[model samples]
Target: MDDKIILAEESLKRNGFQVKIFNNSEEAKKSLLESITTDESVAFGGSMTLSQLEIYDDFKNRGNEIYWHWKGEDRKKELAEAYKSKVYITSTNALTLDGKLVNMDGVANRVSSMFYGHERVYIIVGKNKISKDYDDARERIKNIAAPKNAKRLNINTPCKFTGKCNDCDSPDRICNVEVIIHRNPTGANINIYLIDEDLGY
Candidate 1:
């Protein structure tokens, strides 16, 4: 196993989180499905892994209500409702070898929901999304993740043209809100499934 990945798993384990490392996405899916079945009221935040797994459909099919922030949706209403809702699925932009969850969002839904709303949270990560350190993780989002997301969503942010974070104040700035998950809540629960293959952006 890669030393960094090993470190990440160890750090998360020490924090009282259940860490599962899989060889690929298929294994991740199987494990994830089993985990979800054991829990009640599964909810999902925005995530490329969920999109790759098409896991939201699975949750909905199984009668689990997912809470998430959508692009171009009414932010005020979504934020209000999410405050009290429990979230089960969410994606972190980058995970450092030391098990730091780093992400940037326009509305901060993804980060806040992970830390607060959910009674039990499950974060799915791809090895490609792992970084050497916190600074590298954040930089990856600012340069690679943000620009690619902007292009994919056709956002009109300055970084779309510059191919790097320009710290734009545009309404389309997806990196406006940033959050780091350093530790799981004392009494709350969080689990991380690390997939060896690339899963999401």
Candidate 2:
């Protein structure tokens, strides 16, 4: 095991979070599918990592009530149901070695759901998303994660062209709100699944 993964897992456990480790994304996806039941409703955050997993169709086919603004025709309705779903699935932008989870959002529905309104929260992270410290984690979010997301969403931001954060005042900026979770929220059973390979930006 990588030293950073070990440290992050131990630190997360100490912070009252359940940590699961996998060698790759396939294992993580398989475990998540097993852990969540069709009887329970599932919601998705606006995360590229979640998109990579591509489990939405499977969940829907198995008769799990699904809520994801990215997939549903009525985004507003999906976002509302996601806020109060039985399970919330998402990924963090960055996870520090000391166990801090960091993320920035444009709309904030995804970030807010992590703190409350769900009985269970599953955060799947790739090893490459882990940083040495909090500052580095935040930097990774601004420089790497935010820029890539801007390009994907085709948001007219300066960073979209530069491939770096310009801290612009554009109306379409995607990183308006940032959150750093130092400890697990009391309202949900938070589970952190760490994969060894790089998965998302």
Candidate 3:
């Protein structure tokens, strides 16, 4: 792997996150399963990376309560009252080599839940998601992840046409709330798994 990835991983660790670097997604899947079986409750954030992993099924098969943003039209109401419990399978968009967890969301379910909902949260990231710094990471998600994701969802965002970030506040802004996880909370409640392979938007 590259030095940037190593540096980023080390920085993440220093911030109090339990960091695990995997060689590939297959390895990541195996490890995530182990964690899920041992944990009492497992929750999922809105992560394209985790969605693409398609590994949450394993957690469900094990009789674990897998939580995620409700897709129902009444999700806002339901999620507002959902149990704030330990999450064992949440993924995050890695922002920088300086070790920030930067992310954008529409409903704020994914981002808000990260703060206090789950007693324990697991963050999975791919090496390709790493950037040099906060600005670079933001730029990447704006110019790359956001546009591509909008196109993928057919959201009709400005990025779908401009092919880059104009930082527009259009109603279709896909890059709304952003979060930079500067440090993991006290105790090893948050675990991070970094795969060498590329994953996520």
**Backbone steric clashes in candidate 2, count:** 0
The C-alpha stretches of model 1 lying farther than 4 A from their native spots are 68-87
Off by over 4 Å in 2: none
Top of the candidates by TM-score = 2
lDDT at residue 2 of model 1 (Cα atoms): 57
Q: What order do candidates take by TM-score, descending?
A: 2, 3, 1
lDDT of 1 by residue, 104-180 (tens): 98767678777776677889888888998898998899998899889888989988888898988898888867888
Best by lDDT: 2
In the range 1-201, model 2's lDDT, one tens digit per residue, is 677888999999998899999988889889989999989999999888888888888899989999999999998888888887899999999999888899899999988888788889999998889999999998898899998999998989998999889888999999889998999977568999999888779
Candidate 3 lDDT over residue span 1-201, tens digit each: 766678988998888777888888888889878765545766676677887788767776778665555332565544654445466465665557877888888766777676565666778888888888888888888888888878887876789888898888778887778877788855537778888888887
Which 10-residue window in model 2 sums to the lowest lDDT? Answer: 180-189
Q: Cα lDDT of model 2 overall?
A: 0.90
Query: Can you list the residue pairs that collide in candidate 3?
Result: none
Model 1: pairs clashing at backbone N, Cα or C within 3 Å: none
